[model samples]
Target: MPTVRLPVPSGDVWARTDYETLPDDLPVRVSLVHGNLVLNARRRPVHQRIARRLATCIEDAAPDAWQVDMDVDVLLDDDELEPSEIAPDIVVYSAEHDLYERPIPADLVALVVEVVSPSTKRKDRRIQPTLYAEAQIRHYWRVETDQTAPAFAIYTYELDDATGEYVATGVHHDRLTTTVPFDLDVELKTVREP
Candidate 1:
């Protein structure tokens, strides 16, 4: 039998590949969200800074846990018949497990944060939150960026354990402090400004 080596796809083609064929360390980050592949686009400086600041805040707040960025995926379910995966901007997972390999379920995640970009405003505001809530994620935060004031609108929500759903617990115009995991305070203004 003759051996045939399949040519690897690059750039955008890599993003379009089926989940099973994606190679390790693909040039662009790819995520399977709701059966659709999301390609990582170049981010603006402000967007990058905000994500970094939020990660730092979470780390300081929960010194014992692990905090990560979009590079990691959160697999919501393991049922072979139905697979769900999402990559949020920042995710705080249990410190006890190795998170680099693949998506871990929503139960393992302590918190998820999404920093909005102009291109992803709608998806971030409407679609993504619902998905996270459906996955039974405990805490979800949305960081809205204002171009004029260059400020961030931080909104926090907590899951209703009885109903297994998320409820808007608080909305912060400038900052946020949480009691879960650890005592953490985030200055929304500092994160938004360049």
Candidate 2:
């Protein structure tokens, strides 16, 4: 038999693959959305504030059986991001889930949240929701920061059983008060960007 070598590219073909090049101390965010490289925006204080605040609020409001986590991997597929196996800003799962294992299963996740940024709007507003819905996660939340105001626009979605798509459950601009998975009362306007 003749020896042959496949002509493979030099760099990683996936966004998550390229994400490994980032330095550990770097504050940048990255997501591999369906074999495409979606480089996240420079870290904005407002973005982080929303994500952090929501995590705390959800944890406080959720039942003891539900666990809310931040920046944890939720894998639906081993490689591709179409059936997007990527991380959400925060994921709420059950206490019985095996946290010890890497790449937490999406079925165990009840909710997935994405804090919208200028750079991540398409993914957060559209792409990720489809993926989350396809994964059959019950809830999805998006927090959008205003350009001029010290406030956030939040949207809550519930998966539609018939279509397996997200249905808008609620939309909040002044506050994040809700009673879906559990009661949540977060003052969106007061969340400091600093």
TM-score (all chains, Cα) for each model: 0.79, 0.77
Lowest summed-lDDT stretch of 10 residues in model 1? 9-18
Best by TM-score: 1
Once fitted onto the true fold, the runs of candidate 2 whose alpha carbons sit more than 4 angstroms away are 1-28, 78-83, 148-151, 190-194
Total backbone collisions for each predicted model: 1, 1
Winner by lDDT: 2
| TM-score (C-alpha) between model 1 and the true structure | 0.79
lDDT of 2 by residue, 53-106 (tens): 779878988998899998887865545433245779999998888777656787
TM-score between model 2 and native: 0.77
Candidate 2 at residue 127, lDDT?
Answer: 79
Q: Tens-digit lDDT track for model 1 on 1-194? A: 45434345444332323465766656556566655566666678888788888787777777666555553678765444344577788988877657545656677888888888887788777887878888888888888878523555787888888876678878787778878655788877767667
**Full-model lDDT for every candidate:** 0.71, 0.74
